[model samples]
Target: MTVNPLVLIAILLTTFTCRAERLFIGILEADSIQSIHYGAAAFSRISDLPLVQEQVQARLAQALLLPAYAGIAASETLKIVQSVDSDAPPAPDNPANVAIIPLTDDGTMIRQAFAAAYARHKSQDAFTLYEAPSDTNRAPCVAVAVADRHLFTSVSRPALTWAWQNRSKFLEAPAQSLPGTFRILVNPQRMADLTGARSAQAARIIDLGRLLRACEALSFSFTLEGAALAVTLRATAKQGSALDALLASWRVPSEPLWHAVPDNAFFMSLGAADRPDLWTPFLGAQRHRLLVPTSGRLPPPAVTGDRLDYVAPTRDGKGLCWVQLLPVKDPAAARAAIRMLADAGCTNAVTFSRLRRRQAGATAIETYTVTLQPPQMAQADKTPADPSLGHILLSLLLKRAVLECAVHNGHCVTVIGPEGAIDEHLPPETFAARPLPLNRRIGGQDPALTPDLSFGGFLCAADLVRHTVTIMPEIKPEQARLLPRGGDGATFGIVHNGRTLTASLRVQSNEIAALQRLNREGRAVLQEVFFQIFANQMMDSKRPAAQ
Candidate 1:
């Protein structure tokens, strides 16, 4: 029997049309899981489209879950989502039929990008990947999905009038340069949207911070500047709109901050602001913390579901960043001390680069604890100092805006160190055999403060201009025993003075013997690497080897 088109519409409405988190299209084992494949009759008409098979499969990418997914368009082929089990349950919710979501905005462009990506996946055996913008009510998107720690992605963006690229490459020695500055902050969400409330009150404060800070920069009024977009958005992670909703439900205060949390909500009354009738939207919004830090280097364990929320700035001056919310508090010291309690269950308190300017005499380390929200913090560390606000913001902006890592060959290599620090200009390690002297200012300031630069699990003191090269090799399971086994298939390694090359190879047919032969040849290459590294170190003796 043929399936009705209305059935498709109902499925679409149930899974694709959701506003909170839409499930655009999906295929499932409608009747059972004893077998998994499409039924012959279910997918007959779809294959007639120019590229339906590829198009339907393209939408399967998980990274596309974000705003970048413009929705799927039907293409050349279709699948018959067939029953999977003989002993199938009477009613199975997972429909095996494929879906096609017509794109409205930038629809054509999205279709083209999808087709091209699918073609790449088929021809190159390249992993599909997507990185959708973290926006809602928007299309022309990108999406990413990772399985077994591997990735598949889909990408789309509106017509590029003149994007970040379009510059000249391969310039002749005498070529005149096009001198220009490119600074664009496109589609930055309101703090409320980006913060996505943990509660109405927290959401309000976060929104206020985002708005006020942006306003302070422009010296423009919110109304006149069109700064705040008032929407009844839920403050969930990503758009992180939960704090607003939670606060609205909790009936938290709306007055200027420093009002203590209500005795009812906060176990410890950290002074907050007064409540208001119109300010009801501030409750119930869940603040999205890096509830889990899944960083690649110091990534919290996949099991440790905690967002590697708190990230130490990438040690060795590489890419690193953290986000937090700061509210005005009573007995300012107590509020500041709030940042110190590791167990303090309040809004985000990590000393963001933006807060540095407001924190003049105060110092906040990026680590987990800083004595913020202290009942009497004004008196403690009355003279402590960290990089100034200007410095902090510049650093924050620099990391976000400047540093970017690109995968080279098989390894991921990224740039670090102060934005434009040159390796050639770094001074030699200032040595002292007896307890290296501390960094001292004009007064009695301790001089122990020092920063570092590193990459690909390597660290150094002086600027090293060379890229931190990484090598990745896919070894089949049986052949993986050749190289030291790593987590799953991942292994951590570095080249030593005697050893020069490192790799994680995959082998499907060969076993350990094949790998041993490969390793034997690698020794010569490793020797060559050591000689080159030794020469570079001799020329610039400041860089200690990365551990």
Candidate 2:
């Protein structure tokens, strides 16, 4: 056969061109997707749900233009593996349950899916893809044939390729850690760089650079062992001394105040370590005017230790009120300061009178009753008052209600609340003689989990669900329909472990199983319920000033 050299040359050139084009396009697409992921992660750190929603809506709009992309579909079951590594050995325990919906391999479909997953504000442009030269020395080389701003997909080609090539070793790789079900391994230095590139608007809202410097990595794991969810967080600092100083600043009392609260209390928060300076940030101009007058009267005795406990109405139909306990250095000084403020007319219509004294333990407790007059408003001032004003007014009223002070062991416990509620509702013995239910459940786990814990509380899930449904008639049917059966008796705790300042919701075994069994439809229903509750709470808490 006679062959033309020109024909052979043309064929060779065409093949080479196609291969080169694919590689160029792939690299561009990979970089674009990676950038988008980083941007999404940064937005999430801000904790602005509304802004996140806007972003999602914008992405969904773009996805709507793609014909191949359809709306999300329901799935019956979600598989949860320990790691993305294909050849890794099976976990010794039950795998964690996570909500995930995989996408098709088509470029267009993948891009649409990514958009759906990471909806961003309309103002934020979709990532632009452009061809770039590849570094031959880099392992797991990524290649592509075409670039599509709307159709390109795959968040990180390098990561995916690395995982595939080192399937068995990926989980144990030193570069990355995969110790938990929901793991986030962040390079602090890289995070700092990303934060620097963020918009001025975002930077002004949060100190992302400082935040990233405090934490090296975070992991969340749900295990059947003791039927609980555990969170492990790692902190990082440029120097060991800096890390130590950071932890020291957060140190709280060796013991928690929850033990002193009644078991029936519905909600409670106790701070073991007191830093009055921390409240300075929350003291806005209006609050400063109301609480801090020129008279130099000290603010409510620095609650060296404090407790705010609440209880819901009982079956017998008795409404419950919150009781706050503050330990001070000197009760007399605190009393004098309040009296001076009232005399200076800084307080709104306040009156104080002494009450009976009693003996408890090795201490003699003195009591006082304070009354506050309601704000006198003009008929035309019907416009809703500012939420900040309401809060200030409430604080003033509570300060004058009924206060009991008992000094022992170099500290004074100043209890404040309605006299009737305190006398009738508070148990004779404030401290628990035996281990509380939550303490029993937590067992011998590190005391560090509770000592410096900012907030720690436990509740019966079924009871909470029942009460919520009963109080909010509109959500009753939905709650009843969505809540899994047989998990009623399960208990859950919202704990903020002090050491790492990480929060987690720990659910019992039955509830965990129920959560795992939820199909896509069930999950959606639950999510809707959660969304509604969150929306309602946000609305209720909205400040007039913010509006």
Candidate 3:
């Protein structure tokens, strides 16, 4: 056959340019969180490892931090760290040492808050944000912003506990105070996702009312300007017997958004904890609920190793809590454990936590607690039985605070330990003969799998990064594409350089002999420790040199 009218007008202009590129298609903009700045510098090099500082002091000694403060992530994250203080030096350039409290009051969001605090420290000399300085040898300090005059409190900010700034390293930003300079308060307030309106329609009439009557959960504390604010409600269950059976079938005003539910007053569930005189403001009545190890290399603050989403109180356990400690560094021993637990009259408190897993001297911890009773079914708040894990306890308290800065700066010590503790010695662990097939295994290597953590495996709320994430992305589909799984046998694998990425995985799974297995083997040992620390931090990129 010899067809050629210029090949029939080039096959009808490539079949109408592939049907106008499949009718104006879109959705390919997946990459470019600018790789979240190389995933926040590979989570600041796995939170400055020493086996992630004994898994961020064994998850602040076993409170098992709520999953990555709800940013969401989990392919592998097993922590409980702390073991680095041969001395202690690295954090100065002060202003009451790194404090940023902005739930809102306004000023145009504190002048756009140093452009998101300079895109979250792109030049990290560690601390500094005085501003208006073209550059005067940086760190120039002095800052403060103590406000909470309870703007007529109805839902103020008390127990919110923001991201420990972003795990750790603020040194000086919310500044102000004096004849000198250090004023960093970029206030703009309101952050439980904006509030009010009968507390957002009574938390959407008990989670879109159903057969459920008052399926409850609520926490409402007080005090402001003098700080201390808390508000929580995770599930209301069928708002008023389903608004009295939809107003007897048509009564009007049911529009809490076509009954889609979930406005639980914006959000407070993320494991609400800290009531009866609520106090979580930048935590430092004598700090160190855990986060010490100083510059052994700086690792401790994934907020207990990533996976905390926020909002709890399903049937009782309520929500909200933040305690990232590292204390024990005499302040007369935490003011004598707060004046001997405040002369044994401590009031609202409960402790029995432990998350050390394998570090201090290697393998042996992960204890847990925070139990309180009541709420036979819901709405409990008389105070006590607080077991909230809202969003998997803020994603294991920010990945055990990014594994306590990767065990005081060595990074994951071949599996979590203070590895290069050198003459100070301690770090060690091998475990993992093979394990997985249960709920909470915080640090179990199958001695029949038991160290089992609890806040009840963070009340299995679900949404694990929208179904146990498997992205497998990478692009460049044009040239008139038709790509379908370019290659095969992919239980998992992906690539992309257009930036916009984030990977902090470590996943696990096993069941040998007869079958049932699918392991990522610590995502190939943290994707070769995140590409050898992203090619030595993009060849020490202060930027520019990559020709």
**Looking at model 3, which ten-residue stretch has the lowest summed lDDT?**
149-158
Query: Candidate 1 at residue 98, lDDT?
Result: 18
Give each model's whole-structure lDDT.
0.23, 0.38, 0.22
State, as a TM-score between 0 and 1, how close model 2 is to the true structure.
Answer: 0.43
Among the numbered candidates, top TM-score falls to: 2
Candidate 2's C-alpha runs over 4 A off are: 1-179, 188-210, 216-232, 237-246, 250-258, 274-317, 337-419, 425-430, 436-440, 443-455, 459-503, 508-547
213-306: candidate 2 lDDT, tens digit per residue: 5543333332212333345443433344333344444434325345655655555444443444443332332232222221245444533544
Candidate 3 ranges beyond 4 A from true positions: 1-369, 376-547
Candidate no. 3 TM-score: 0.17
- Best to worst by lDDT, what's the order? 2, 1, 3
- Over 127-227, each residue of candidate 1 has an lDDT whose tens digit, in order, gives 23332333333233333222222112333211010110110110101111111010111111322232344333555334444432221011000000011
Q: Candidate 3 lDDT, tens digit per residue, 1-547? A: 2221223223323332343211110000101222222333333343232243344334222232111122212221211111111123212210012222222343234424433333222222322223332334322232212232100100101111111222221211111111010111110011121222334454422321221222222111111111101111112223344322322221111111111112221111111111211222212233222222121222223122211122222222121222122212232322223222212221222222323333444322222232222213335655423234332333332222222112222112111112121212112222123333122232232111122221112222122221112211221223112211111110111111111111111112111100111122223433543355445444533457457
Native RMSD of candidate 1 (Å):
26.0
Poorest stretch of ten by lDDT in candidate 1: 216-225
Candidate 2's clash total is 9
Poorly placed runs, candidate 1 (over 4 Å)? 1-547
Native-to-model Cα distance after best TM-score fit, residue 427 in candidate 2, in Å: 7.8
